[model samples]
Target: MTAHRFRSLLGGLALACAAALPAAAQNFPDRPIRLIVPFGPGGGTDLIARIVAERAGAALGQQMVVENRPGGGATVGIVALVQSRPDGYTLAVCPPICATAQSLYNPPPFNAERDLAPVTSPAELPLVLVVPRSLNVTDARGLLAAARVRQGGLSFASPGAGSSGHLAAEVFHRASGTQMVHVPYRSGAAALTDIVAGRVDFYFDTVASALAQIRAGEVVALGVTGTARVPQLPDVPTMGEAGVQGFDFPSPRLRVVAPAGTPAAILARLNAAFTTALADPALQARIQDAGGKAAGGTAEETRAELNEEAGRFGRLIREIGITAE
Candidate 1:
């Protein structure tokens, strides 16, 4: 064939492929989908991912497999998600860790905003300020007073250097004008154990993780991190309400994201499936029981929330000088 004829043929083929893209998306998830949870099994993110996937898979007519890839402050798995093909098969469950990864890492492997496309947020949970029953604090003001007197003598525990709990504590110190020694741990359970043993003075832990302890009277919940009190702990006042102004730490939002450049049609389908799953009455109750509320909305809403959280936490991380160890 002549050179001109060959060029024309290539153009025709490109148009044909472009035309078929939407049809391909329409037949999406012909196979199982992999949902990566960037934390170890049994953690809040992993548990929430499993619950949502079990129901979303039914909506999508395919199996949604939960894959744990825990490392690098939850960025290892997110980096993997970023590198995956944007065909809508590989997705990830992103929590507050994702929002802070870029801020905490010296040079993050992937930018959550640039590399991942938000699908939807499945749930959100507030962190609660909990202290050992042995401590004498009962509210935010009392905790701040205690910290002020002790200065760096009092210590706060977190799952790790950049986890939500860690940043929340940092923000609390910044807003309350009190300083406390930061104690980083390998896991939330470990941190909670120390707090229960009175090894640590306080910890900002998720309601889910600290609920049992709070109910058992092992730890005292000083305040919740949300703008409003959490239903699970209705009597617990918000940090702002408890006397700490501008003390709202962004709640941990569980978002679903895919590799950037995924076809818009495919993203829409995935969003619909997940949102429908979140709307199920059984799923909402289960989420509430787990100390969170179901949150399902458009991809744009998720994107906005993630961006807002990243900006808010990034400023706090910089102000606190928190670096990944």
Candidate 2:
């Protein structure tokens, strides 16, 4: 072939490849995207899920429907997600430790860390340390002092084994050097029952649940788990402010992920949509109003946060001698 003809053909081929690039990036979400939430409705996780689904769906020009598959401390929905097609249409709204559930919770056949790849973090909400109002404990220090007087016999309740509440309680336990008996329950309602009845000594719960109970005089939030006191629970001090030094928040954070082997392009696309949508005033206000702190970051941040929480929790559990039961 002539040199001129060959050069012309190469230029035309390059132009054709450039034209297809847009299709490759934009072909996503030709239909609805199913958002799998690993918890029941109305809790902090549910609220975040709905916010992301609604906002991202609007941004992506597709529908993002949230599906609750709550069971086994979010393991059930995750397992279902792992088994889903990795076409970017099926994504999961997972808590930070959804990746570490394998190490923290009872043996599920699959390793979540190996099975999932992060898309983005929608928001994070720190739970509060609280006790039944009848317990007359108004602060973590007071509770610790009372537990110290009780000699490690004060009982506490958590939603389930290895849940964020359970792990955060461990963090509180380590920081306060207090040993309180854990009373495990299938759900927060069940745990709250015993707590309000004064059968359990203390517990930490997400704002969506704990704040309501705190205002009703059913439980008293000793303090918030974050660095600053939440606006809704303004009267309550932070965990550190409540006299537990070095004890930061035990966060109830949500991250999005897909089954491993999903393409990086898809992850990047999803992350862009999430990052953009989360910054919108309506979305941010809705999330904050629902007792969550929206966070937008790269996929690496989500992965690192999950890993850090797992490592932190694993040590706390072992140090506290928390055995899986």
- Top candidate (TM-score): 1
- Looking at candidate 1, the ten consecutive residues that score lowest on lDDT are 145-154
Question: Which residue segments of model 2 deviate by more than 4 Å?
Answer: 1-24, 105-108, 321-323
lDDT per residue for candidate 2 within 51-166, as digits (tens), equals 87888888889989999998866777888889998878899988744745656655643575688898888887878877877777767777878878886567878987777778
Q: Report clash pairs, candidate 2.
A: 225-249
Question: Estimated TM-score per prediction?
Answer: 0.95, 0.88
lDDT for model 1, please: 0.88
Write the residue-wise lDDT of candidate 1 on 227-287 in tens digits: 8888899999888778888776767888999999998999999999998899899998888
Q: What is the C-alpha RMSD of each candidate to the true structure, in Å?
A: 1.6, 4.8
